[model samples]
Each structure stands twice: as structure tokens, then as C-alpha cells.
Target: MLEAIYSHLARRAAMYLWMLVVFVAFGRYFTLTINVSDSLPGTVFLVQKGAKPGKGDLAAFRYNGGGPYERGSLFLKRVAGMSGATVTSHDVGYGYRDYFVDGEFVGRAKPLSKAGKPLKPGPVGLIPEGHYYMAAPNPDSLDSRYALVGWVRDSQIVGRGIRIF
Candidate 1:
């Protein structure tokens, strides 16, 4: 009888350990993001691992280089132009650069930073394969309009941002 009790306890312990392993795996692969930047509205985002972000999808990626912000920082922005798309910028007026993708007007690029410093405009012409142009509806947002956060590569993409609330 004692042998049977020990066997049952051992099986239950093994099942619990397996459950813990699965939970850890899921938590490590997925994350919840609380967006604090005005680039997008404040919301809780559910980020899934390995999700491919297409045009118009809000994505999180690791910033490769440094500029206004720290390097290796995770940035969240909307995918404006995708692979094989054409992105262009033209000075509309007052030093504002307007962006267009595939001949469609996207948004105006802010030439001045929040501190009144000039910002470098993003690249123009065809977006090479495996890269993406990111932007936000807010013109003042520090996004692809500046060279700091230029075309994001697919390999740098972490996951798609899904608004939870």
C-alpha cells in the first residue's frame, strides 16, 4: 500500500513539474507591453513570439544603433512601408517633410526634434527586401521620419503588438 502511495505522489510531482516547464516557456516567449510613448495611444499590448508583422501592424523591434535614445532599446512603431514598397519624402513647407509610399501620401515627417534640433529624413526609393519602414500617425513622433529609427530589418523584429485594452 505504501509503495502504491509513493508511486502516485511521484506521478503527480512529475505532472506538476511539466506544467511549470510549459508555463515558463510560454512566459519567456510571450510578453505584455504597456505603451507609454505618445507615438501610439496608451494601451496594454499583447506581444506574441515569432509573429510576422506586415504593413499597418504595430511591431516591436530592437533598435540597432543609437541616436536620441539608447541603443539596443526595444521600440514599438507601426509598419508603414513593407518590403518592395517605395518610400519617398518631399518638403511640403515650413521644413516639414511629407512621406509617401507607392505614390500614396502617408504622413508628414517632422524635421525638428522636441528639443528644436534638426532631424535627418528617412531614406527614399524602394524599400529593400527584408526591411520595413515604421511610422506613426502623429507627425511629431520620432519614428522612421528620422534616420535614428530608419528602415527596420525583419531579423530585428521581435513580435506583433496586439492591443489588449
Candidate 2:
């Protein structure tokens, strides 16, 4: 009976070790992220490490913000403008300005945040190389339209995300 128990325990240990090895090998190639915030349409996404970036593609990057979202936290957003694209900001009226990439409307920068804190619009002119403009359909999303999320650096990007739900 003792020998049988030992065999069972060894099998379980080997199974766990095999699973860990598999995860370590292909973990970076694929991952799953859950979005608690309703910033985008999906709550679950499958991240592809080597996926290409394009306009309207979902990109995952590290957050570099203050308060609530800590630095290095992963945040998923939409790719609005790519590198070398001409970005412009126009003060439409009130405390809002419309942002565009290559003259195509991307999103609007709100004058204030959900907390009512005054917010400033993002950058204009050409986007630098290895940088991208990200946004979210939710108006209250803290996207690239504000200084907090200014521009998403290429180094900060983790991968391209595909909505699973």
C-alpha cells in the first residue's frame, strides 16, 4: 500500500512539472488577459506576442499612469495611429478637442476626467517612430487622447490582442 501511494504521488509531481515546462516554453507566444474595465467591447482577449500592428488592432501595453493603475500594469487599448502617421488635434468647442490620425478622426479628448480633474489633450503633428496612438471606444477611458497615456512606446507594447469575448 505504501509503494502504491508513493507511485501515485510521483505521477502527480511529474504531471505538474510537465505542465510548468510547457507553460515556460510557449507562455510568451500566447497569453490570456482579462479586462475588468468596460473600456473596450471584450472582457477576455488572446494575446499574440508576434502579431502585427495596424490601425484598429487591439494592442496590449504596460500602463505608465498615476493613481489607480500602477506603473508596469498591463492595459489593452486600440491602435488608432501608427508610427510616422500625421496626428492632429483641433479644439472643436467647449472643453473638448477632436484628435485625428492622418486627418481621420480617432477620438475626442475630454476636458475633465471621470473624477472631474482637468485633463489636457494629447500631442499633435507626426507621431515619432516606434510609437503609437492608442484609444478606447469608451469616452471615459484613459487613453492616448490625454497626457496620462500620451503615446504608447513600442517597447511598452506587449503584443497584439484578439478579443475572445
Candidate 3:
């Protein structure tokens, strides 16, 4: 009976140790994010911190904007254009521009922001190394198609986002 009790206690101690390591030692490796925008498809995501994002992957980045978008806000967006990929934009009339990556249509950008601010088109040309073009299905999204959210650098990539909803 004593041996059984000791074994149970050991198991409990081991479990607690593992929990402590996971929750405290490596807590920064994982994060939960809630998406409040139509920029992406899901409402919730589990971000794998330090994970390298690839083409077509959902990446989380710290947002740098103003006028409703808080600076340093975490944003989840799609990696539409990868490094070395060609990104081009052409006038689509009515002060709008369409963006393409590697000859594939990515999305379009409007001339004005939701707050009635004039918006400039995103950069056009080859995507530089350590940079990516982010996009969203919703055209109103302030992604890489506009100067406000221009090429997202690798340094800004927070993690790979796995959508939960």
C-alpha cells in the first residue's frame, strides 16, 4: 500500500512539473488571438509563436496604423505574396487599383479609407527578401495593397495562425 501511494504521488508531481514547464517555461511559444475583422475567414486562432509562415499561410503580425487601428495591434492576415514573388498593381478605374502576384490576381485596393482618408496604392514590383504581401478576401481590408500596410517584413511576423473558427 505504501508503494502504491508513493507511485501515485510521484505521478502527480511529474504532472505538475510538466504543467509548470509548459505554462511558465515555454508560455511564449503559444498564443490565442481573436479576430474582430472580416480580413480573415476565422474568428479565433491559435498562433504558434516563432513558426515560420509560408505562402498561403495565415500569419500574425503587429499592426502599424492609426485612425481606428491601434498601433502595435496584433493582426492575422493571409500571406498572399511571398519573398521574391512579383507584385504588380494596375489602375482599375475610379481611383482603384488591382494587385497581382506572380501573374495571379490577389485583390484590389480602394482610393479612400473607411474614414474618408485618401489611400495610396501599395508598392509594385518584385517582393524583396524577408518580406511578404498580405491580403484579405474583403477588399476593404487595409493589407499590403495599400501604403498604410505595405510589405510586411519578416521581423514583423509574429507567428503562424491556425484558425479555430
Q: For every model shown, what is its TM-score relative to the native structure?
A: 0.83, 0.87, 0.85
User: Model 1 over residues 89-112: C-alpha lDDT tens digits?
Assistant: 888888788888888777787768
Q: Which is the leading candidate under lDDT? A: 3
* Residue 154 shift from truth in candidate 1, angstroms: 1.2
Model 2 CA lDDT for position 73: 89
Off by over 4 Å in 2: 1-5, 11-17, 50-52
For residues 17-111, what per-residue lDDT tens digits would candidate 2 score against the true structure?
88899998779698999999988998899888867678889999998877467999888999999989998998988989998889898888889
Q: Output the number of the TM-score-best candidate.
A: 2
> Candidate 2 or 3, higher lDDT?
3
- Whole-model lDDT for model 2 versus the true structure? 0.88
Ranking, TM-score, top scorer first: 2, 3, 1
Candidate 3 local lDDT, 1-165, one digit each (tens): 999998998879988788888887556798989988887778989999999899999999987876468888898888999889999888989999989999889898999988899998889899999999999889878799988789998999999999998
Order of candidate numbers by lDDT, starting with the best: 3, 2, 1
TM-score of model 3 (CA atoms): 0.85
Looking at model 3, which ten-residue stretch has the lowest summed lDDT?
A: 62-71
For all candidates in order, the CA lDDT equals 0.84, 0.88, 0.88
